[model samples]
Target: MTVLLVDAANVVGSRPDGWWRDRAGATTRLLVRLAQLPERRLSGPDGGVVVCDGVVAVVEGKARDVPAPDGVRVERAGGSGDDALAACAARLAQEGTPLLVVTADRGLRARLPAGAAVAGPGWLLAALDETGCVPPA
Candidate 1:
């Protein structure tokens, strides 16, 4: 089973799609999109099928209060979202779980444990689109 760790703030901030107006709403939208994804498979970076068994979205700042959908777990960060993500990644790595981290932050990417697959928010949005999880424009 592969666990997907999302940096909610980074992903929500990527498109500049009026997310600045309401961060929590944007985060909620993202989580709803993620929850809509098919449970069995997603397109991998290498063009193969990646099984996503779990999803964890780390939310910070004003977005921390946003509720998560059924298939997605929302982690409200007490401080830095990046720090919470890194810590979760580290714990998952220690448990020998395959991890896919979705974020565009360079520093946060560097902080992730080795062997974890990293993808930018663009990739995530593309996947969501491919899966017909389109959000409102």
Candidate 2:
């Protein structure tokens, strides 16, 4: 079973579609989209199937209140989003669980636990589109 750790702020802010203007609203929309990930068959960077048993979206600042959905958990980062995500990855990795970190931030990617796969925002967006679980408008 694979567990996904998402940098919610990074993914939500990847596009310039006014996310900065309303961070909470944007994060809420992103959380709704993430709720559909579990049932969808997503493709990994290696062209293999990416199946997630659990999805954790780490948010900070104004976007910390997005509620969790089935198979998903909304985590509020006490400090930095990167640190929170990295910590989650480390904890999961220590348990020998397969992990995937979703974000396009290079620095964040570098900070993830070893053996964790990294996927960018575009990858997630494409998968969501393929599964017909498009992001809320």
Candidate 3:
């Protein structure tokens, strides 16, 4: 089984898609895309989790609520979003589960456990496209 930990903020902020000006829109698109991941069969065996640095909800400070796909969970970064992701990957590695971390940040990529697969924003965009999450031209 393979576990995927996503740096949702990085994925949302990656491309020159005007995400900064439309953070909510970008996040929606990213979340929608993430929701499609398993249906597209792109997620590995263990499933995926989308982690962000901000609060998960509009009213809740401790947790924000985001729509998670059938096999995905949306989580706030809390202490350290990236740190949590890295730790998840490390735990998976210890369990002999293949780990895949989705993000374009070079530093975060470097911190991943050995044997974890790395994919950048471009790759995620492509995957989303494959799943028909990216709007049609």
Q: Rate the local accuracy (lDDT) of all candidates.
A: 0.87, 0.82, 0.58
Clashes of each: 0, 0, 3
Q: Per-prediction RMSD in angstroms? A: 1.5, 1.4, 7.0
lDDT of 3 by residue, 97-122 (tens): 65567777788789988768777767
lDDT score, candidate 1:
0.87
Model 1: what TM-score? 0.94
Give the TM-score ranking, best first: 1, 2, 3
What is the C-alpha lDDT profile of model 2 across 17-132, one tens digit per residue? 99889999888887888888775567776799987677889999888776766767877998888888888889889988888888999998888877688888888777777778
Model 3's number of clashes is 3
lDDT of 2 at 19: 88
Candidate 1 wrong stretches, greater than 4 Å: none
Candidate 1 least-lDDT 10 residues: 37-46
